[model samples]
Target: MSPATSRGPKTPVDPNAPGPMLRYQSNLPKLPVPRLELTLQRYLQSVRPLLSDEDYHRTEQAVREFEAPGGLGQQLQQRLVARAKDPKIVNWMEDWWLDQAYMGYRDPVVVYVSYFFAFKEDKFRTVPAKRAAAITTAALEFKRQVVENTLEPEYAKGEPLCMDSYKYMFNNCRIPKKPSDVAGMYDPFKNTHIVAIRKNKFYIVETVHNGQQLSTNELEQQFQQVIDNAGHIPALPIGALTAENRDKWTEDREILLAAHPENKAVLEKIETASFVVCLDDSSPVDRDQLSRACWHGDGRNRFFDKPVQFIVFENGKAGFMGEHSCMDGTATCRLNEFVCDGLNRNKINHGSEQVRSGLPAPQQLQFQVNDKVEKAVAEAEQHFDELIGKYDLTVLAYQAFGKNLIKKFKCSPDAFAQMVIQLGYYKMFGVSRPTYESGQTRKFQRGRTETSRTVSNESVAFVKAMENPRLPNEVKVAAFRAATKSQGAYMSAAVNAHGVDRHLFGLKNCLRPNEPKPALFTDPAFAYSQHWFLSTSQLTSEHFAGYGWGPVVSDGFGVAYMIKNEALQFNVACLKDLVVGGKTYKNAAYHLKQCLEDAANELRDMLIADMPAQAKL
Candidate 1:
């Protein structure tokens, strides 16, 4: 097992345990710095598949020169290692990375940064009001657990992940600024209401009154009131202004707040609310519909700043939207799983109190808009619609087999699925190029993710062999094993913070103002390989019907997949289908589904053929 996956020391489960969330915080090892030579060597290996032989040779020479003793690369690596060892730096890369890769990135969050998850079908609460009520109650329950720090920490293979991200999962908002952005977390007790958006209008529904949480019935009634109050008349879509670029939104927000000082207080109330509940008018069925609904609805129906937004659709279908600044998918996935599972199993405390006569009715937040604000909202709506419309989304729920079958074949499920991705990409584009797979690095304090380079020579060979009709079954099976093994090794290295990308990134980050740019980074192959033709990540849960994000690049595909016991679900996204050099990326989801099914069947046949007759039978 990789250091990232190593099981934590077994401890007895005690409900009365003190600070269980922080039990392993002090002793957990700090993130490590790999040797510069290893990182350079791996860098060369990763880039070779994406470049011409001549270009690869030039890049390899550049890497060697960079790795020489007393070189700039050496100096930078040393600086990074020293930073890691600094007594005050909890995690060396956290601040720089969060700012550069996320906060400082001045893009629209809708089709760029935010992620979404479609919840599993809820059978009991078919009525939209009941579903919203139950969901709100469940969320409050989870919120209480989070506030009290009573929720059990999530584990992977029985190993505890850093639960630090959970602190930002509630009562948090991403505030826009001129050059960069900032996040704020408020006291959970003070944020006692949930913001509800309907027909582009905002409503504040108080969750706690008289020191008691409102019952599910009360919540349902409030939700119904909001819906009824929002009838057919559309209000100014001030929320859509948030879907603009951070810099742009910052300017517009200033204009908005200046229009009416009261708007400032309203904005804070929405941002500092415990969470948001978006009662969308659209009722969607199926994975694709639900994903599209949750991913980026009319944009008017969302406050993109809130970390967690539970989207309850008109048909009672629900999902979640996450602001990427505060936390990642895994952290929010745990929260979603808790909410959905608790509601489904009837494990949440649905308070028994009826609607008291003295409780205030839900209050609608009003925004005063002038011509400038009106134009800004229109522009934002147009951008949101066009950007989301240009992209295609499809969900591939392959129920034929899943991780159980892969394990029965004695292979790592993730590695096997990665090969499936490789084969699928090759089948579509006729080449195996640079690929990115996110490996979680939450084993360390404040750690996020490291890039695992998935495209290697072994993967290429496997894809070629799989595509060659004349190749023997045994030969193909051997190639498959080699490819999966290589993938597994790279993933382990990534999780251990020994991957090439972050180290190189750190080195680049450490360069002095007067220092010349490193030849290794300036090389053409460096940019080409990191272009990331296939940006992929996996967060598997039976509770999620679909989950995904936008592609990192315009020409690439963002493939987010979930591995279940009996099925594999993929949410493939890309910009408009393009035909470049007679290679098309249209209907990528369908093609990937076909390729995965084909590869799995071929692997099963080859493994069965290699087994002895009795064992096979």
Candidate 2:
């Protein structure tokens, strides 16, 4: 026995799916982090399958396009140098990365949140809506973060912030699919389809914010109000941009379609995909009639009226439409703050009177990234570039052991984390320890550039631990001491310190050159026991679960990380097709359960032996 498994949860019940109930435990306390983090997600990044040749060529093409003359790259470069700005293509590219690397983990994770809204007609038309948010804050935060921290250090000196995180562009590779390639069968197990878009560039429109959220509906109505008072987009950034002064990017559908360049590939990708839906049952939401008419604009489901709208498509399909460009998932949970700051404070009281006359408002403060880390990143890129010359490998990937895989783990979170680091090391070099089941980090390197690939991260369960009352004080002490001690030691060690420093560059310089760089050097070998007791309800909704949008059901996965109690629960999921069996999910589920049970038993015995007196029931 590994020392962390439960001895039947103190009270009798079953381990399989829901049916009749039995009282094991409830309303018990829990371990801090959820099972998802410990198992499916160790937090940094996860391993993915090897990339196909088709994937590489499409990706390489995107890298070249970024170099297009007077194109997005140039626009971004100009912006960094105080000349121009473009967040559209940048944002779009990121959305693509979420599609691939995170394996569409960026796709909407259908959340059925219960809410009752007070209706304008005085009747609360409360409805249960499906909601989704970006699971990869890393992708959304890429541009801003690179700008804030690691870019200048890894990038060549003098390179534009426009190209700072160019590493992200490789994320756009995927031979664009036609909707026909995947119609009607896009079940929960699948993601992505052909993207449909109107090429009329003139009809395309954009608006930037300076300091506030711009509500389009409110902006349209308040064009006169802002003119009547001091103007802007009612829900937009403070840099008031009324529609009268704005111009529609296109007018004719022909131009819109023609405007988007087509290769034999891109033309195919949008065949099934639809444009970003912007219409509300009755009409297109257009706010251009107000202000000086600088730009013109226009364009769902029976969604919700609240900021967090959820939609449950047929057969477990779901989607989320969030109007937040600046807010993150953390901020989304705090809806009241957004309401106060985004809507109420500046309703129709403002609009057109504040519109800029020419060019556009000067950008707000932009940070200067560090030079050293940029150098290191450039070095890493160069390493991959050099490797490409020496080897013809086409795909790269990494894998880490999960709770079920390790039968005899002491089961401390710190030890589990160290095991992940080891896995990453093993993937890159094909080396793993005898106790590999304890958790090991692995990485596969098979690219010319740093764009290895991304896929949906799945099967992370985050159930709280240590919430049971039957567990003795001695058992509690043994588990707590081992887990905490290991966590603190790793937290204080050098390798983790390097990670902390490498990741913390933008905030303030903490490490000086030639200083002892922190490290964990080697995985720990010990006889400490770690285990936990947890609590559960009749139903549980996993947090941060879903894949990125992609074509074919063959490419979907989901993971939830939460605490079950003293033990961490990581529930991993993938397309039934992707698993080893012809279509049996039980393979993965049983693998995890058996692996966890073994580890728990071993740890319990170890702790019992370590006690001064036999601690038993």
Candidate 3:
């Protein structure tokens, strides 16, 4: 079965069971160790296209010498296998990966570690109060399922995936520190309130009263009260400081905390809340507008520490912002899908339309910001405006074809889309370079991700053939098939924890002090190839109008694509100053849009020629 197919849970599950989500948790497989020989072979295949012939020969020699029977590669592989087999270690790479890939890095989270979703507008509920109330009601239902441990586990290809990350879904915050960051999880039972931010003012709204969640009408009433009370009064914009770099923000946080003794209490309340609901004061119409609205409001209006923040606009549109430190996109994607699905299907309780009188009002949380904090907030807001302004986002809702057409030709939709990306980059740059695509390893316990190096010699050949006007359609089609097959094989290997990148990472980290660094690690091609020029991933959902994050490197493009039945959507982002071959990456959105349409059409035409004579006629 393809990785896209979901097999049912490994063990039979009872719908009424209390711990349904955990039924097969203990039985999940441990991450595997790839054979050293197979890894070296895959590594060579992946890196060949990125290097010159001479460099490729040198790298090949380095690999052969490193893989000798008594060499360092052999020794490190043994150590890695032994570590994986250690009785106490659930997954050998989890902690090290979490730190190096996410937390320990010191870039600003807005453009790097944070991701955003642009939600479809609610036509039925045009008022902000009504929309906010309904979304909160639906979100609380999801929280109840997770907190009660009754939510069904997710699966891919009929195999149960790890559910450990869901525990950090609610009531979690990523706290900043000097050299690193740490995550804290508040007990969901104790943190029953949601933090609502509007006009740079914070309010706490209790979801439960008299042993039941607030009715939708009551929640709306509370929201209305907050709007009326806050009354467009401008506060000091303390939340804006969060958009700064970690090291800078850490210092700013201290100043705010020392501004007043009560300021610390306010910070704690926002951090410990179950989740955040930002009632953005603007209305957005299209994908770009909605995405920017949800991505980040005026920096002053957001508290970025919470892992999940639901942003609802005045026009009743909503989306989510995720702090990407403690959890990966898969977990949050599932959470958002569940919440939106509940609302769509009416499975969530809308409660009575009648408002209950005399309920406790939402409490306003205020901080004391002195001159130092005031200046810092101004600087943060300025930086945020300048930073996000540099990013240009465009949505390619390609209506000509989608997964339906790709699957008709017996192709994986994801692999087909990936090829389109490669061809698109080659069209713009006249070269194939290192590309990064995220691969899930969640079949194992606490597994997060493995890099599925997307560039290969087959892919390069395919793109070159497609771009050459002298080539026949048959030749291009053959190259396309070969490239997709190569992609599928590597993806399968990655899902099984046999991919070369992570394995190499583990081996290098375990090297003994006396051992000399392997020549393979020091190769210029190794460094150049790992510097991804195109970082792409696919996470599709019907609930979102658009979703994506900024590029990982300055010169790279963050290409996040979603495949729906009738169309494909892409959210392409990059830095303002990024340029390649004298063309600015800022203009890549337009170029990519044209390239995707062209590639899809060109491939469709080629496939049509392969049909039987009668069918074609």
What are the RMSDs of all candidates, in order? 2.7, 23.3, 2.5
For candidate 3, the per-residue lDDT at 515 reads: 82
Q: Against the true structure, candidate 1 has what lDDT?
A: 0.84
Residue-by-residue lDDT tens digits, candidate 3, 107-134: 7788777888777766777888888888
Better of 2 and 3 by TM-score: 3
Task: Give residue 576's lDDT in candidate 3 (0 to 100).
Answer: 56
Instruction: Show where candidate 2 strays beyond 4 Å.
Output: 1-205, 208-214, 218-473, 491-571, 575-617
Residue pairs in steric clash, candidate 3?
5-157, 6-157, 6-158, 7-157, 7-158, 8-158
Q: Which window of ten consecutive residues has the lowest lDDT sum in model 1?
A: 1-10
Task: Return the TM-score for each candidate structure.
Answer: 0.95, 0.26, 0.95
Using lDDT as the yardstick, the better of models 1 and 3 is: 1
Candidate 1, residues 1-617, lDDT tens digits: the string is 22323444553344544576656655556778889989888888888777789999899889888988898888998999999999999888888888998899998988789999999878888777788899899888888887787776766556666778888988889999968899988888888988999989999999988988899989988899999999988788888988998998999899888888788899999989999999899989777889989999888989998889999998889999999986888888878888887887779888775677787889999987788888888988888887777888778887878887667778888988788889888887788877899998887777789999999889999999989999998899899999999999999989888899888888899998999998888998888889887889998878889999988877788889888898887788887674434576676656666776776666667766776666644
* Candidate 1 local Cα displacement, residue 61, angstroms: 1.0
Model 3 steric clash total: 6
Off by over 4 Å in 3: 1-18, 512-515, 581-586, 613-617
